[model samples]
Target: MRLTTIGFDADDTLWQNEQFFRVTEERFADLLTDYAESKHLKQRLLEAEMRNLKLYGFGIKGFTLSMIETALDVTAGKVPTSTIATIMEIGRELLQHPIEPLAHAAETLETLSGRYRLVLVTKGDLFDQERKLAQSGLGDFFDGVEIVSDKTVETYVRVFNRHGDGPDKSMMVGNSLKSDVIPAIRAGGWGVFVPHALTWAFEREEPPVNEPRFREVPDLGALATVLAEIEST
Candidate 1:
């Protein structure tokens, strides 16, 4: 319970991210409706995303590529030029979307800033993540930012060691169990799961059964209380 540094995952945890993706996905489906059913198009796009994760990593750019690839696949490489243009436009719009902080995001960060060293630990395109962080207006509340390629036990360990004393004195807070919670816990740190209403399917994972260091909160507003309880234990 002697947490000295706390890391936060950006995307859905602190800001409005997935909703934009969902919107763009819906648009993508609409653009391709003539060639494929909505359900089938969605399935193919998701498959493309999963397949391209290693090659493109994660970001709007990668997502754009996946969408285009899916379009080509579904249309048998005969997708109209206008459709491609629209998909690219969708990507540009997504990239330029405003960064909207979630409710209590700033307040929670402000509250925690005084008590613990706060760091932003997130994954995605470096430039895009940096841009969002800059736009968030929450940058000053963080002691450091780690825009990693992926979240893993080793990744958390390295980040904790570099930014704080060690994983034993660190905690990670975020919405994803796969990327944020389980990895942090496995790295010998406490993990606070703040569930988001719209999580990407790829980021979903079942919480560990009966783990004391793993906590689930309704939202970021509950984080301070959870931390206080952990501190008292």
Candidate 2:
């Protein structure tokens, strides 16, 4: 069947996201330089983030807390209060980072807005996601918006069904294979991988090698053409 619903991931897919997090992490490592090396500190912070995901979930707030926890751990609870404040400040900066829409992001959305039922299926802090969308000036192009905590097969099934025909007639396009592509394809929808320059370590996964519904494009600029090919077939 022809695709009807198109779900786009918000973070690195629509706008700049991971780069801010990387910069904040560098600042975080600098704050703990006295206690640990930068490389070791980064590893510890990643561990803290993974361990705290269930408790804190995703986004800047959780990431901030993880930095605090890692600092305390590395310093044996002796990380200075001033340093903690600095880390928090860095996190705040990340929260307030300007929303930069990636190249072709706007025009792609503009092209597909009327032709398909476009829904933003993104996962992150609710307020931050909302803020980015508002600032993007492309919110009007989406028929629906889903700021989910995580993307899963069930999430795709429900989102596609609610916004359009069903998972069978839907496509989820984004930069992360694990979150945006894999689950959507598993849920009986088309999964398009548009790899960003950087992806979170935890979100990396092997692509579905033989999945006919899976398509990888260089960027959003080619998204419309891929959809056209899918429709023709």
Candidate that scores best on lDDT: 1
Question: In candidate 1, what are the lDDT values of residues 1-233, reduced to their tens digit?
Answer: 48899999999999989999999999999998889999999999999999999999989999999999999999999999999999999899999899999999999999989789899999999999999999999999999999998999999999999999899999999999999999999999999999999999999999975877899999899998988898898
**TM-score of model 2 relative to the true fold?**
0.99
lDDT of each: 0.94, 0.93
Which tens-of-lDDT digit does each residue in 60-148 have in candidate 2? 99999999999999999998999988888888888899999999999999999888999999987899889999998889999999998
Error of 1 at 145 (Å): 0.3
Looking at model 1, report the run of 10 residues with the lowest lDDT sum. Answer: 208-217
Off by over 4 Å in 2: none
